[model samples]
Target: MNADEVLAIYNDLAAENVPVWIDGGWCVDALLGKQTREHADLDIAVAREHAERLRELFARWGYQPQPRQDATDWNYVVATGSGSTVDVHVFEFDDEGNNTYGIEYPKDSLTGTGVIAGRKVRCIAAEWMFRFKTAYTPQDKDLEDVRALGERYGFKVPATHRRPAPRL
Candidate 1:
């Protein structure tokens, strides 16, 4: 998705008062205050209470769930006929801020805000994104994002995130 499209989606969610925390690659770009790469889809985390409402909202926009073998109640992708898709991760928190259902996102991970196209929006924090990216063997894009995020935020990029030289 492009920046405008991202902002448009954010605007719509905001208009409907749907709380969403931007996640995945888009979250990294949002934290950086710029778009670093083209995004295939937007990722967002929402409170479990709002999941059904979100589905209804997207239904108005003609988005339907794209069947995935791994699909679960907590996570899935919704797509429009126009090719735009939003990957939704649902979670719930107890009074003490611990996750109690759906995705096990830590409460602190949702406390970040970033500017996207000059509009401040909620997103996954850079530190959390860094941790998530490094928790697995990094993809080339993950490595690139980690490098950039480390440079911008003064974190140490793990050696495992280093991209190997292309074969000649």
Candidate 2:
């Protein structure tokens, strides 16, 4: 999805009092305070309890639920009748407010909150985003995101990320 569409969706959900955190590439852009590239889908994380409401909202927008993959926390994809899909990650938080095991957000990982295109948003903490991106085998886009985060916020990407050193 493009940035405007992403912002529109967040605004609509916010109007209904649904809380969501931006994740994946858009998330990396959010952390960097701008859109760095085009994104195929929006990645969002919401409290597990809100999954039903999210599904309903997307359904109203002409999205249908697709089957979730086995052994992944990803709840489902909301696909437009035209086949465009948005990935939704449903996560349960513990009584202590920790995102449950295998869920992406760690306790205290939401470091910055603000409004983007009039939609309020909470961004994945820079450190955690760096850690999360590093876990996978690096793609060119992933490396670009890591470098952008580092350049913008002085965030250091850990050695575990399979990306080569950022160009000087």
Candidate 3:
């Protein structure tokens, strides 16, 4: 999806008071304060209790539940019948008021907040994104994302997970 479409979706959900945070490639761009690349799908984190509402929202957009292997306690993708997809991650908060559910992101891993198309947006911290990107064998797209983050934010991802860039 393009930035405008991404922003529109987020804005619509925000208007409904859905608590969501941008993640994945689009999230990297959001963290860097710009759109660094094209995204095939949107990634968002929502509270588990809000899943049903999220489903209803997507249903209104012509998206339907797709078969998903439970990767964790709360992660899955829903797709439009035509193939567009949105990856959803469910999270819970700890007593310290830190996000500690689903994937284990350190409390301090939350970096900053910004506005995307006038809507307040939360993004995965740059350091944490770099850490996550490096934790996997870098696909070309991942390498590109790492390079973009480095270029835009001066955050260098280590070469630990370096791999040949994926052929576009």
Candidate 4:
């Protein structure tokens, strides 16, 4: 999705007072204050309490669970039956800031704020974003995000995450 679309989703959630944190590649670009690459979908983190509400909210846009082998009550992709998608990652934490359900997001990791299409957005912190990107056997897209974020944040990307050779 483009930056404007990203902001639209974020703003709609905000208007409903549904707290959401932009995650994945968009989060990296948000933190960097510019688009580093195109995105096929949006990844978001929301409290488990808001998951149902999000489903209801996005339904107006023709979004529904697209289904996947990895789909869970807390994680799944919603789409309009075509084009881009919204990948939702739901999580909850107890009073002491330990994960209790759904995705494992440390409380501190949710404290970041960045701009999308010139509008501020809540997103995963850069340090945690970097940690997450490396905490996987990355695809080429992940490598590009990691490289840009690492350069901007002074983190050293591991050798496994290579810069992709240019496509002709």
Tens-digit lDDT string for candidate 4 (1-168): 989889989998999989999999899999999988889999999999898899899998788888699999889999876676999999999989899999999999999988888988999999999999999899988888888888899999898997756899
Please name the candidate that would achieve the greatest lDDT relative to the true structure: 4
Across 1-168, the per-residue lDDT of candidate 3 in tens digits comes to 777777887888888988777888887778767776678898887776777798789899988767766654477777877667788888777788677667566655555565555556877777777777777877778888888777777876677544546899
In model 1, state the lDDT of residue 57. 96
Ten-residue region with minimum lDDT total, candidate 3: 110-119
> Candidate 4's error at 69, in angstroms?
1.2
Rank by TM-score, highest first: 1, 4, 2, 3
- TM-scores, in order shown? 0.95, 0.83, 0.81, 0.93
| Regions of model 2 farther than 4 Å from truth | 71-74, 101-104, 114-120, 158-168
lDDT of 2 by residue, 1-168 (tens): 887888878888888888788878888887766677888888888887777788889989998777755535445677786656778877777898877744657767666564455555886777777778877888888888887877777777666543654898
Q: Kindly give the number of clashing pairs for every candidate.
A: 0, 0, 1, 0
Flag the better candidate by TM-score, 1 or 4.
Answer: 1
lDDT of 1 by residue, 14-84 (tens): 89989899999999988899888989999999998888889999999899999999999899999998899
Q: Give candidate 2's error at residue 97 in angstroms.
A: 2.2
* Model with the higher lDDT, candidate 2 or 4: 4
Best by TM-score: 1
Model 1 spans with C-alpha error above 4 angstroms = 165-168
Q: Whole-model Cα lDDT per candidate? A: 0.89, 0.75, 0.75, 0.91
Reference-based lDDT, residue 128, model 3? 76
